[model samples]
Target: MNTNRPIRRALVSVYDKDGIEVLAEAFKRQGTEVVSTGSTARRLGELGVKVTEVEKVTGFPESLGGRVKTLDPHIHAGILADMTNPDQAKELKRLGIKPFDMVVVNLYPFADTVRSGAGESDVIEKIDIGGPSMIRAAAKNSASVAVITDPEDYQLAAQRVDSGEGFTLDERRCLAAKAFARTASYDATITEWTSKHWAKPGTINVPPVNADESNDATNAAKTTAPADNPQFPPTFTRTWERAHTLRYGENPHQQACLYADGLDRDGFAHAEQLNGKPMSYNNYVDADAAWRAVWDFAPQIAVAVCKHNNPCGLAIGETVAEAHLKAHACDPMSAYGGVIAANSTVTLEMAQNVRPIFTEVIVAPDYEPEALELLKTKKKNLRILRVANRPHTRTQFRQIDGGVLVQSIDRIDAEGDDSANWQLVSGDPADRATLKDLAFAWRAIRCVKSNAILLAHDQATVGIGMGQVNRVDSCHLAVERANTLADGENRAKGSVAASDAFFPFADGAEALIDAGVKAIVQPGGSIRDQEVIDAAQTHGTTMYLTHTRHFFH
Candidate 1:
């Protein structure tokens, strides 16, 4: 690769002209001719820079209302012609086509226009076709051309031309990579928008192809699948932009960064930090856990305290202050240096109650003025975030070793009013008073890791045991935590229990019953579900089958 190639002729066409004049001045100083399109040329000429219009260079006027401006042999050949090949150079000279050594371009703002409530047809018109074409042509011929897509890169281009030298091969290749990514992201945004608007539900009228009639069974199978089971019309594509770099990853030694699909996204990704030092990686993890746990009970004054991505305490109350106090009493030891989230605005009384605790972060939909001032006075370094209370995405995603795993979010109605799948296959159905706490425990347990158990009394968490190796162990841990809180007087007595999954055997049910759990809620899918129900009956305890598993891991 040639390390240094002088940029003698430059073409500058862009929708954003923030730094175009400075670039034009640098090109003029280097004796490089500047060629541009309609508005770009007019703007540059007005800035007192000499410019050549695209019509003069290409010998064709801009047509189709500016859509067919740069898609010409003259423009593409100038960008793609091989300067090193003698035969190619001779052909270019015979045709009187001058080679372009540099291209500076920025595409139309399709994403911004779509976001700004523009009409569909208006947004569609803003998608730039010729700009990406020129960018790709210049990038493909990076050996002889330099491509610049961002205004931030103007300084790099100016510095090289001003140094009496040209761009190195490495610099050109780097810029080419960026140009390709820009085009790809732009196309993906357009695809997403079109799919959302045009792709609708309809049955495929075509009959399924018969596999037995074809000699090649594999081909027949592929052909019949789409007709038999139609899916969404467009292919799925993901796009993300970098948010910022984190201080570190899960540990201080590892590096990490955050990225989001959009900047206006709510929740932890776009939370407003009102008062605090910068949040760490662990703070983000815990804060997200706490936030989602609280959102499960939104429109209610609910509170969730989390540690290590597991909820340590959860409670629902009529007032924010009462919820904070009750949630803190669930497991005071585990709540140390934990993250807390509230469903409604944090009141001043709630802030004062939790201010004495050594909490890492506090998050809510909003905060009262007095509450915000009190919290800032209490701890200068505590992270306080206010989310905009938006609806969460329907899908959840996680990264694996080689690929990603995505699934529909567990938006089960824990209260059982919206679901017809719930069953009461046990000694007896939970009464109205107990069912409220059962629903509370069910929602809270879903945010914990697998093999999870939670015991609640009067809509407040008494104990939570999560991430155990076995269901029986989780039951024991929950019982132990409750007993410790009650000073060995059996606080689990008459409390409702919820599990993330079904019990494999009757021992877990018997254990919970012996520990004074009066009622239970589980998914009820194991083969020994009858035995577990028998155990519950034998211990004189009631049980309800939700028929829905809410496993987090």
Candidate 2:
């Protein structure tokens, strides 16, 4: 079969007209016949390029508010015809239908329209019918027809035309793959939006049970099956556009690429990189973890230094610089080469403090001009990103062996901050200052991995121990780091500790108390809760039960 096919006759229709003039110029230079639809015909005409309209080729004017133009057999036959086949070529001649050697088309901005909060009717109208049909038809016959779906590829298509070589078989196949991906993502977006808007509670029909058979089994099955389209639908489809290929994944040996959800949302995916090299997989993972950690202490200037997707140091202060200083003090050894995130703007003072440190990435809502300049000049390898303050997605997804686990994000609610709701289970009640430190530790602990233990003083973590198999080991690790890493004093002395979950045994609470933790907070639902409470009382450590576990696995 012939692989090289020249773009002698082409069909062009697009909603985004960026770089279309290049293709038009190529068509004119190559003396190629162009058939365009609706505004595209006018656009090419305005560019001083002569073009035949779709109505002239199809002998049918566009109807249904410009939705029925390209759906005709005339357009699809021209696109899909295998001209190399002698019989197909003769049929095209018999019908007086000119085959299209190339199809340049881009679909309507349905995703963008839906994201813009447009009305239902307006969004429905934005879903392209003929556009996908033409794209798919041309792509299916990629050996004979070249399909262009992105404006970025228009220049390449034009260059191929100008070179008079058209597209190679390899190039055509690549373009076809991209075209199919575009249509697939478009359909996925439409499916997601429509499901949310149109889905209703549906009932399942059950066969009548025999009089001797048990009705209890049937009743249980009915209750287990979803009666309505809840958060988890029967079918789930999500689409992500490839942002760029990363240098590597978590390891240098693995290949990886970044994908974005194609939404105008505030997140690390949409963050603006102000300076430094491209981010790595580990950098992004740790940066996002750090960002979420700091933001959990919202309305206050907070900072978090994360390593291996775990918060190593976290703190709140009057200023971002102060917060960084205190947070860095929490485990300076671990903060080295870590990703840092600030809830407030990064100041010059903070940049100066961070300059000496070999940090991987630093992300904040914004950065002072001078701070950004300093980092750009000094830290050439450090990734500096500016994100916006907004609520993150409520749902979180984690992949398991065969399927994904979906759950609501463990957001630190107002109750976490309110010590009033906490029960003073053991020892005396904490004072306002001690209660404030307890609250900070509680909020910060949510970012730690279970079994997690955090020791904090003056709104700053003194030590963090996480991802241990046993809670007792985590408590000991936290205290050991706090005392051994302190500059001149025992950092755990008079400090408060927070556990992500209840202590299954008294040994965990005893370890924290023995390390000089003055106060402790935990969910407190273990069967041995009384034993842990008694241990805390014996050490005169004030322990509060939140009755809410924040186990991050």
Candidate 3:
């Protein structure tokens, strides 16, 4: 690679004008001429930089409503010529095309255009055929050219070009990878739009093309089997960027990376490291996992304390600061180094109460200026981020072996009326505390996997036993653990119970009654609802029936 040859001429086209003037001046200082088209040339001229208009090279006016300006071989040949190939070198010289030593181009705002509610006709017209074409050409001839994409990368590119290195081989390779990723993301967006909106459902699913598990099959070159079938099939094309690097995996030796979707407009993807240090791998995974569990509630203040991806303590409070104090108090020993996410703005008082703890991460929608300043001073490396609520239209996504799994927002847990649809044969109308406990239990049950049991006290979950095989056993686990986790409060004693699904027999409710639970809440749709209600009434417990069943798995 000729790293020392000065850039004689460069093709420049971009949607973003940021830092372009500084770059143009640097290129001119290095004796490299800047050639651009349309708004780019005009913007450069306005900034007092010497820029050659596209008409000078293409010998054509900026015509057809500015659409046919830069799509010329005179421009592309300058970008795409191979200095290594004798034929390519000779043709470029014979055609009077100066090989473009650099290409500074960024595509049109295709992603943002769609996001702004533009129609397909309007959005499709904004796709830049020339910008990406120029980028690919420069990237393909990286042996003698430089490609710059992000405005953030302009400084590095300027530094390299001034230092007379013309971008090291490694930097060139990295730019090529980024360029391909940009184009691929554009293509994927188009594919998803075509498949979901333009074509009917089930149009893309076909039988497996190859019974292979290699990386090539993972790519979308061939259509595979139908989703949900037993045969391994690569489905949706995942587009995610690294969220952060963790200290380690669940075990120390394992490696992990946190990734956000390509089109993440807000929330965790845009979480800013305000004052403190970088986040660890576990901190990110646990913090986000806890945030997901808590964002289901309303905009009110809720505190979720997570230890190793499980909730050691969770509480909803009157204020963000109060929630922090109460949630931390749930099990201070367990909350020592856990990740805490609040469903509201974190205040200074909350930060003061939590800053002293040896926790790894603290995340919220926004933080008070004083709160961040104080916390940053105390904990020089605590990862504090501002992403208090779920982004608009949040979707839960996961990867399973050969394919991806996506589901609804997971917050839609309640769906029907208890008084009209549920059958109850037991005690009288439940009291206020009983209803609140039922709501708490409902919320807790949705967090648990199917066949789960949740017990609560004072509108706070005391014990949650999830993913059990038998209903009775799950009930027993929740009941037993509540006594220990609840710190002898005895919520089960004269307290309420809520089940995610209806009890098939009287035994499930009986298990709680034996533990001194005085009330019950459930969907109450089972054929044995009479028996369950009889057991509840006989046990002197008021049972409220919410018709909605939250069977999460």
Candidate 4:
């Protein structure tokens, strides 16, 4: 180890000049020299630090338009040499290289430049040639070097380097670990960008042969090709970021988060914190469920009330206020401490009505000033969010055992076409209100488990039979709840039903139909779809087939 090396010497170069000058000045005050390269040298010199440029140490001018500034062996050997090895010390001495005990570096503008709509060539050029090399070198010799990346590290790094001594062994190890992660994220960004431009983002809606999911074999490049491109088949994929954290998860002991798609990171409507405290995990999850349910209505005012990821109340009215009232009336008990979401703005009258309810969140496009004040007075802890446009992206993810499962978001209910594979199995076609109730029931059922059944009336979920051991038991449970919530008005006696998957036999449907489930909706892919149809016909019940099955487990 070069025993004659100075007690403190730092080489500082960074793209973000956030706290560079102060760090440089501190290094100088500690009786240690501050060496820099290119713009860093000029910036530190301007700050009146006796800055030594890289060219002065390496004895070579930067060529290749200044890209060759810090690629010299003099700088790298100092950072990479094994300080514990006497042979490495002798080699460094023969090469006349001084040890660099500290290297402060942040990468080139690649992440920022590519994030902007920069041209492909411009983005490729921004990848740093020497910064990552220096960082990796210093990190490799962390036992003898201190490396820092972020602006938050400025004070700690300066104190360690000028703390009447120098950095301890453990601190250098932590700094080196951070440097490695910084490089990894940088490389991932570059890889993502290469995939974006090479594969061509937003190219789709074509036949298999004509599909643009293919690329030219002759132009295949390592960076441009995906991680497992042609061998595994490249399916078009999209991504969205976590917009906000919720207060809590399904249970208080668990945690949760929510995300809004179809908006850039800084888009105004994407989880805008217009008012109130931060949301909880459960609050965010239910709010997302509510908003996603209502966005399907599009260009109209519809309200959804969600608790535990299932909509308890939902309604569409001529005005937002009417929708809120009708939906609130659907299941007043379930709506307590739930999440409310609508497709339109929160009006003063609607907010006035909603203010009395103990809701955890209210999400919409906007809120009137009086409405905001009214809601603010109701609950200081309530969370409010504004989102613009319909959320159209359909990416759902689940984490399990160090692997992530990605699937298409449930979109079967969006079509509103219950007729294609649907059966008018009973005596007559449904009325407008019955049809609406049937649609709502089907949408809610699909969100449940495989052997799921939903009984709904008055535009609200009467009861949901989820994850039952048998289809018959699930039907019985749903019918019982429907009857219990019927208000003795016989709503369940004339209500609609929905199932996520087809019943293997007709008994489940027959039992529910006989129990006064007037209509039914299920995916009609089973071989016995005809028998189920026949049973519904015998029971004088109406049936519809979604064809697309929603089997959540």
Model 3, span 144-238: residue lDDT tens: 67788778888877776676657666667788788878777766666544544464346656555565657774545334433533222245553
Candidates' C-alpha lDDT: 0.84, 0.88, 0.72, 0.74
Ranking by TM-score: 1, 2, 4, 3
lDDT by residue (tens digit), candidate 4, 1-553: 3222233777888888878766876767876677788888888888777888999988999888777889988889888887767998889889988787788898887856754768877877888979999999988888677788878888877776566556666777887898897787667566555564576345543232434535666235433444345221254333334566766777778776764432233332257766677776666667877888776655657888888887676767688998888777656777899989988888999998987788888998889898888888777777888876566544457889976665557775444345434655555888888887887676556545557887777766666676787888889877776566547554467778888888888888988888888888887787987898899887677887766677777
For TM-score, the strongest prediction is 1
Worst 10 residues of 4 by lDDT: 260-269
Name model 2 segments beyond 4 Å from true: 1-7, 46-49, 80-98, 111-125, 141-144, 155-174, 192-230, 377-380, 414-418
Q: How many clashing residue pairs appear in each of the predictions shown?
A: 0, 0, 8, 9
* C-alpha TM-score for every candidate: 0.91, 0.86, 0.72, 0.81
Residue-wise C-alpha lDDT for candidate 1, range 1-553, written one tens digit per residue: 4478887788999999998877777877877788999999998888776899998888899999898899889999999987777888889999999998899999998877876778988898998999999999999988889999989999888877777667888888999999999898888778767766775455535554564665676675455445333122224465767777899999999998877654135646878899888888889989988888888877778999999999889999999899988898888888999999998889999999988999999999899999999999978888999998644765567899986765557775645523244677776666788878887888788798889999999788998888999999999999899889655657788888998899999988888899889899888889999999888877778888877788877
Residue pairs with clashing backbones, model 1:
none
State residue 486's C-alpha deviation in candidate 1, in Å: 5.9
Deviation in Å, model 1, residue 101 alpha carbon: 1.0
Q: Assess candidate 3 and give its lDDT.
A: 0.72
Report how far off residue 380 is in candidate 1 (Å).
Answer: 1.4
